[model samples]
Target: MTDVFAGVRLLGPPETDGEYIALSEHETVHLHEYTRIYAVPGLYEHVVQERLRCTSPQVAAAGFLRAAATLGLEPDSMTVLDVGAGTGLVGELVRHGGVGRVVGVDALAAARAASLRDRPGVYAGYVVGDFLHADELREALRPYALGGLVSAGAFGGTHATPQALRNALAVLSSGAPVAFTIDERWMDASDPDGFGAAVEQLVADGRLDVLERTRFQHRVTTTGEPVFYQLVVGRTG
Candidate 1:
């Protein structure tokens, strides 16, 4: 019985479902193995929160609520589109934020299945596909007139490519808000083509405006080291 992905604690003897590992050799696993990871039941949670101590979902959701409050907007009036909604954790957070309708999009079918299996009714609709394409998904959610976007811990190296951001930006209604968090290490103020610079351009060009950004601990790596991320809330201007 081994829980290879369940954080640093050497829990009880590994059951058939859990993969146990020694403390020294744990940093090699990739993060997107949703099927293998989710199949272990509570491994994702244990690894993400118990082990890594990830808090992006909760932080981003709370920031969205506060920004909405600052604008005198009702959270219940928001129709939210959650991009890369792995396991529906972020979707549940948005629902808890009082969003009127939630549409979840993910590239992996296993993610959708896990969401339905573990957190049914948390999302109004779940679509499985690449979110970088706008045309196919546009009509699927047209009825909702989506006013907000939630993409917690989704944007990254390849997933957060400029083209992807351009496309995700195309799916929103003007003036709609978008909230997300990205690893701070992936960003740089001096690097002109960096993710942080791109997002800052989106804000400066009047396409968006940064409402709030807080540097916080997102979680831990397989090696028992803390990983930090920035929770960012912005609006389509």
Candidate 2:
């Protein structure tokens, strides 16, 4: 693929809070400003996937497939809810992995538009709503009978919060699978995101039965350093 980001330059590693410079436009944008990134077709793929080498989508999909297999479930028999489904990257992977249906949920209209524009038909439906305030969305999703949930690269900093995760979990049927990946730091006990404590409580309270938790390099930073993320696969208890 041609380098769509040839005029874009990434500076600093993730640990140092990386920033990007668009040489052609002479503008600086944060690495996490996904709305702006998705506005330009192939810019996100070029910067995040090609340049930084993000692999969360593939890793999360594989984890979800493994968890489904462990539960004696076939992917084609499942409908999955994809939280933070940015540009349908994860949803496309899950759909190609044989999921019967994939519904995407993102707070940004730009994300939904980008998904439809780039990977048309990947998601059976895409809803724009805050997961924390999704009572109507929950009711609307009932018809899909979502059997699984997957989130990738959407659980830290200004992204989805632990409460959003809990809200997503509330919609899944008992025993339905859930898979997600987050930066390892965010999983640390002291992290302000509260994802670590929330996950622990879910497991302790028998709300989710964790099947696998693996730490892997989620991506390479702009400086070519590794950024690790933890992939957690589980089933609702």
> Which prediction has the highest lDDT against the true structure?
2
- CA-lDDT, candidates in order: 0.73, 0.85
- Residue 65 CA error for candidate 1 (Å)? 1.2
Error of 2 at 197 (Å): 1.4
Q: Residue 116 lDDT in model 2? A: 98
Work out the TM-score per prediction. Answer: 0.83, 0.92
User: What tens-digit string does per-residue lDDT give for candidate 2 at 32-137?
Assistant: 7878878988788888887788999999988998889999998998889998898988999988888989999888999999999999989888988777786977
What TM-score does model 2 achieve against the real structure?
Answer: 0.92
Q: Distance from true position, residue 189, model 2, in Å?
A: 3.3
The number of residue pairs in model 1 that clash at the backbone is 10
* C-alpha-based local distance difference test score of model 2: 0.85
Q: At residue 80, what lDDT does model 2 achieve? A: 94
lDDT of 1 by residue, 1-237 (tens): 235643445333234433333334543333555676666555666667665577888887777777767777788887788888878888898787787788898878888888888889998888877756667777777776777788877777656565566577777877777788888876676777667887888877887778887789887665556778888787777
